[model samples]
Target chain A: MTERWKRTLVAAALGLALLLPGGGIARADSWQDRVSAGSAAATARGTTIEIAMLDRVTGQYRDNGPAAHTRIESASVMKVFIAEHVLHQRDLGKKAVTQTDLADMSRMLRASENAPANRLWVAYGANGIIADIKARYGLTETGPTSNTRYWGNTMITAHDMVVFYQRLMDGSGGLSARSRDWIVEQLRQSVEWGDGGRQFFGLRDGLPREQVISQKQGWMCCVNGHIYRHTSGYAGPDNRFIVVVLTREPSGRGGAHIEASITAAVRAMFPEGLVPRVQGQIGEMWVRSGGHRGPLGLPNTDEIPVRGGAVQYFQGGGAYWSPATGPHWVIGSILQRYRAMGYETGRLGYPTSDEIALPGGALSRFQGGYVYWSPATGAHAVMQPILAAYAAQKWETGRLRYPTSGEIALPGGGVMNRFQGGHVYWSSRTGAHWVIGSILGVYKAQGYQAGPLGYPLTDEVALAGGAVSHFEGGSVYWSPGRGAHALRGALLEAYQAQGAERGSLGYPVSDAYAAADGTRMDFQGGSLTVPSASSTTTTTAPPAAPAPGAPTGAGTATAPVAPSDGAATGGDAQP
Target chain B: MRPLRPAVAAALVLLAATGCTDAPPAARSDGPAPATSSSSGPAPAPPAGEEEAQALAPLPDGVATGTAVLVYSGLGELREPFAGQCSHDGSTTRIEGTADTARIVLEVTPDGARIDLDDGGVRSSSELSAGRYEVSGGHLSLRADMTQDGESTGTAELEIDCGG
Candidate 1:
């Protein structure tokens, strides 16, 4: 076979190599033949750990067979099915994306929003997501169901996962080749879960970055005695090798053993197995052995206790509370929240129910605790484990939308930062001192977070932003700025203010931030937000530029608003 | 298909004459020009960088990448290598459909153009040429081509507003 085809075969071999419970690289026969005999591997494992792989080069499929139908929870793997179904419509010209559609899909794929996936499900049902895969790429066994038995009802077997990946690669996923490439790219780019639920240990475990592995994992404490760990991913230069693993019982702590086993098996199957492994994304043994963890005898990471069944049990209404801290659903401290989310370390922004002091011993209210999900809006739980957003939505639930205001106890003393509009306000006890930032959806600032998060608005703070008010950065900074009304009113003022310009782009784009001497900062990949502190900043983009056009700047000067959240405006849908 | 080539070649010549100096880009984001009717055929591409040069511009909301679905007129017929100084006298148009709305504009210059949509927000642009252009609901059929036709080259089924 040609080198290209041979490499494809090698990648596929690695995915299936791990199917054998005790079968390390040396023992597994030609990986192709072994994988082709999917049913053998199904019964081959002690506990029946069936793994299926797809070779994108050829439309042919490999399934560990009926074992894939035992119907494991689809978990986040469902997101792939949803994406395929949606893209299929896009390719067939059966649907047009709305602003909401893009945003929803983005959250589903990038953030793995469960509710949003459901919304898209209406149009792209299993028949659609699955049928498209089968029709286009000849994918079989990866079917869609209204719900799964596992976490939040999204489940599929190891065999099915491979089938889905197969469909994604060969146009059977229902998306155009270009769309398939995009989906693969997004899955590959993901390092950690946007929702903090990335417990799957397959790809990140035993691979190299150059040979990026795109995968997702699902974990839930099963009542049946097994802590299930299900995962699926694509590996390769062109994402030719697809692997899926669904475990009946998981190893202790974070299911790392399951991941390690898969990783060890995959590692041996490639490079060392006479597969002319490309230099890309290969496991570097020295790197693995080179480093030691931390001074505390703990791996360089903090030993944050894992609240295992918190989201799993309470995903149905999980309440969280520490022994010392009583009766609270979320962990209040920012740093503590990250630890709660399984991160030994993370950025700040966790909410503690107890009052704690800030950088300067200021007491700020931090309530606004609530679990919000909307088929209309994505799911969000702004309380503990640090205020993180989830891929949830308001289906039959009420649209309280983040209780609006609340208070939290900080560490060490009185309080930390005040909270409002999705930001922490550093305020002195005196009313005169306060700094709020990156407010959600530009509403008039509610004066200051005097009351709690859900404080009833007597008359709606004379806030800024909306069809009317227009402010530069995210905060109210100057008079030259258009009032919320000015923004929505005349075309001139409207043209000057850029709204939603600073939200996170799924990827980087051409951005120009002016420096002190008019030296514009132009770089790639990093995201920039208007300092919640700035007022007179201006950004210029072509309101009339067309395709195939040369580029530049000149005319009317306008400054656009940056989104408080780190997401771009366009995204995919969950439903 | 071959029978239409001669006419297509002749049409190309005519298009080049009128369209050589000015043409829109591949797709527009500011909606259609004032002169364009709602039912008018797809707009042409305005020149690149023309929008910012013409109007001081607002910071772009974001940049998006897309393939060229259709090239109706003007620059649509040219093979210029991504660099051509173009301004408009109405020979081509750049039309595009976003998540919610469709845009049409003209390239008054290589850097900017006069937009006629609710173009009051931060917007962006791109350059693409390929893919079949399909715009239904209007009356007009034009073939894809090469020869340069003078002024507003390809036949766009635009209604004549004589009252103006």
Candidate 2:
């Protein structure tokens, strides 16, 4: 074979790696083969554990060990079949299943109340139910106990239990829709039983509330000198699964072990080995997150297909999984960015955290970076130097708040991030510098680089009770007392002519405020006013006059001739 | 699909943020210009020199209290209206409204003014761009444009006395 073909064959072989018991990854033959291996592994350390699973979506039925064929005494779970038979009788008589009957069924199914079960068994005729279930529902391995007095001893097989659940969902068990629903409703009640009743420890114990089976439990101690623990019910969305677990343990203390084994097997069949419980505020947000004509709603499909052993797809988004990072939601634009970065296989690796709520947006942290989303900014990834800078600034709680725009390339090839409070500009020469407060306000108002003050030459510099920032044109000074003021043009020249801040005028009290008289800059002691209309002498001055570069009270005054470049170095200069 | 917009769509003259489809001619806020049904009528000039309401009536009982449902019209379309509140003191006036799923708070004072709006939950505030307040004939009308950060969202016109 060619080298490329050899590599492809090796990858295919690795993709088929089966997660076998005892922490071994064995190459599996197929999905069913893996299921068989898992079943064998589960039964090896047990006495007799039988499990039956039905995938309603694909109409596939699989049984492990002696679960399908072996007949075992159905303890209280037989109450479900008995109630079904009783409801069928009522349906045949064209009679409504009364509220009292529903109450009795609830007691029988939910609480496993023996009084109602015996009453219903006798009312429907114990032998007649067995014959009806066998003939009508085609359940071959189900029959009433030989001793009618012990109604709980009815023989049942895993196959018959699965069939019974199937008929309930398909509405083919000779029971009306209302009657069937009433029985199912009863099964859903009292899922977590108290006071040492058979607690929901089988199929229901291992799943989330939304995905747990509405199941019935059957436990009978010392029945034929063996303890029985069984749980069977329909689970998943729209009752899309029927799972049956029957264990005949030597001692009654094996219920926990039985539950764990069955849970493990069920999880093996699903992606991430866990269901996305989608609950509470997150559920409300997801179901109604999008506006009209937007792409958001409840899950459109029941199966969250496992792709590449990690990522699972839903309607709006999906849950990604990994051994290191666990599982987290990748939704909307964040999901878009994650996919663009090649998902978990790329630089972001696996999502190590769930979508966390921010003030105006949400973020999901990953191994390498984080994806943040806001209605205004959509979603974008923050990684490496930019992310590190944000973290040092305390992320969202700091001055930056949330990123208003992603890290965009500036016109001159530097990088910058626009945030709610300010902007972070980065270049190889300057590392990452934050521009905020009134200085940022002035910079933004001046149309950034597109306006007079090109790019910032230095970060904010500290002065006595104030701070100043240097730009291409001049500097913006800010203080708690004076706000922020920009000094350039003739204003800078006039201020420097009087020894700047040490002279008559203090640090600029305001940026240039317009007035009818002229654009004025206020100072601590007095004010320097520039005339909107120049005097006749200045107007009539010759070409060699200092009129263009001087700080006279004239409208035609220009910037002062000072330093060679008129730009300061990037440093926090102390006053 | 949204409807096509004409060049100069006639707007329902309202207060700064309040809007009503059928504001009667008599419902005109304190203004000098007569209420004209034609869309091309000149904007009523702001209350000239002595036209500002003297007593100001303390804004009526619950006019500035509780919530006022207001509709916002801009960019040639009338968005769905929502409810908010407005309040005024002697020196400052504040009009708060909700539009496009955002809370807009307009605060105008003698010295400085600001208008804040939310994009998602992050608030964006900017200096008031332009404002015209007229209290003519015991009616208060306000027309103002709002700018958040540096971008202009839209204008709001309200007839304050009509409890809009």
Candidate 3:
């Protein structure tokens, strides 16, 4: 096997170097020629390797090597046959299969544990099951050694092993479906055993993770002073073929060579050895992240090329593997956020969608809480409440527009966000509500609840030509034609007596523009002049007292010159 | 309504029509704009003396003016929104504004009102950021750096609103 491997490597190298010289004429080198050329060196050293292959799909097969038909020591490969025979007995109710027996079968096939093989050999009537296997499977060269208790020393040829595998795969040869399935399932989980259990050599190591190989390996030292290392398996994405390689290493230095030789031989025979290696950084990442061992498991297909990088599909959300920054998982609303942020290289970077389950709903962290989307909210951010308030009053869309800022915490535990339309204030008490248009402007000028009027007690209620929001100490009344104003104390009573926005005095124009008498609150038609303390009288006059200074009329409007004692009522309280 | 000064008003009409915030600087210096202007023909020279060149007439009473919005590159660079009234306080014009919690300053000279945009490093106008503006009657268009494939790469904008 070692000699054959060296020759194949040399020939493969020659095939490449000969490519340019023999540019047009294709060299059709048969598998036999390749094998024969590779075996010359092994023949000189008296080491012979035998191989038998069965194409389960086409039902055609081939066998080669000096000992191809010669019976040799079976080693642990006999365990596979033993396991099959026991399963058949269990199926026919000749012997009941226990959970412990199944566990032993796993240990035997996977780790090549000997105790389970011996126990099953005894339990299933050893030689009787062996004879049954030989007669039913038509395995001409398979039989126990002279030592009746030793199943490891059972003799078998490569051809007989291939025939046995074929029957096991086809669910024939006197075995039930449950028996074949049990045997194959155990064989598929073969772990590294010899060489301190770190060696995943032979056919298993040679193939990539995408291909499924179910094989039993045999290794024993000093059998007639010859080292035996052999691997026989059914492998392919669909387990479409069976291969048996038997090796007798007298010198003990060529186990790896034989494995490599068999790997190359199978590649030459099958053509598609394994799925083509996935390319790029994402591919490299997949391999690094435990290829088939991680939660994502094996790639079902090749790395699919994408916008910035590539993706390999798996059972879970496949790794958005990349070379640049990270190869992370993307799932759920977090996935929506990542896509909105432009996928991998976007501001959110690679989506590490580690969804920490929140008390209600889930949050996938990203580059920005700047844009958060709840299924209930769609994608709207702050300030919609403010716009919705104005919108209710027929404010034109985008006419009263964009938000000036994100929601900010107010002094009294309420939250306020300003927008082109107006402002939205949210409290645990009043929920989220809006204040906009002229009424909003008046509310803002009155130090926004820190003034004579405290936090809003009610949503704006519409009047004839305007809207009004009642506050802790006052009411902000607004009219389109007259603008917004705060009417409190004597001023509010006078304004209420005259009606409201549709009153004889009209909507309050300025908040409280100061007058010489004291503080004068204006209206579209007149003014409510709260007299100085010395006079103690409130007078009503036409809007001609103090000068209307600027368009945004500057005023020291002191809501009747009284310091309002309204509580900071919006703090977590129901308004 | 307050009456606008005749001289300043005429210049303002052209400035407003063109959205010419960086006009005087571009017109005076041998920058990218001046070179392009010179390439079209010869750029018009400035008024002779520096003081005369810098001198600007007082804005009409009750009229709102310029706002200073800053622009800078690199990490940790702050940007305050341009919002408030651009007022003249005798020799030096002090225009203070606020956007949300951000304090904005509009630095005005006789030549024009401009916010000192700190670009952080040496960069041409082509490498600078695009800015947003809310001006009364001016068309303020901002351009930013383009990538190797001719796609714009910078995220920050150079906002300059000449509205009070």
Please tell me which predicted candidate would have the highest lDDT against the true structure. Answer: 2
Q: Positional deviation of A72 in candidate 3, in angstroms?
A: 1.0
Residue-level lDDT tens digits of model 3 in A360-418: 23444433332223444332223334334444534323322333444566777777655
Task: Tell how far residue A425 is off in model 1, in angstroms.
Answer: 92
How far off is residue A473 in model 3, in Å? 96
lDDT, model 3, position A221: 37
Which residue runs does candidate 2 get wrong by more than 4 Å? Answer: A1-45, A55-66, A94-103, A140-150, A191-196, A204-213, A236-240, A251-575, B1-164
TM-score of chain B of each: 0.18, 0.41, 0.30
Recovery fraction of native interface contacts for candidate 3: 0.00
DockQ of candidate 3 (2 decimals)? 0.00
Cα lDDT of model 3 overall? 0.52
Which residue pairs collide in model 2, if any? B14-B157, B14-B158, B15-B157, B15-B158, B15-B159, B16-B156, B16-B157, B16-B158, B30-B136, B30-B139
* Alpha carbon lDDT at A531, candidate 1: 29
Residue A470's C-alpha lDDT in candidate 2? 72
Chain A of model 2, TM-score against the native?
0.46
Candidate scoring better on TM-score of 1 and 3: 3
- Docking band of candidate 1: incorrect
- Cα lDDT tens digits, model 1, A121-237, are 655553455455545654344454432211223435665566556656665344688777767776776645433234325445434432567766544332122344455777666
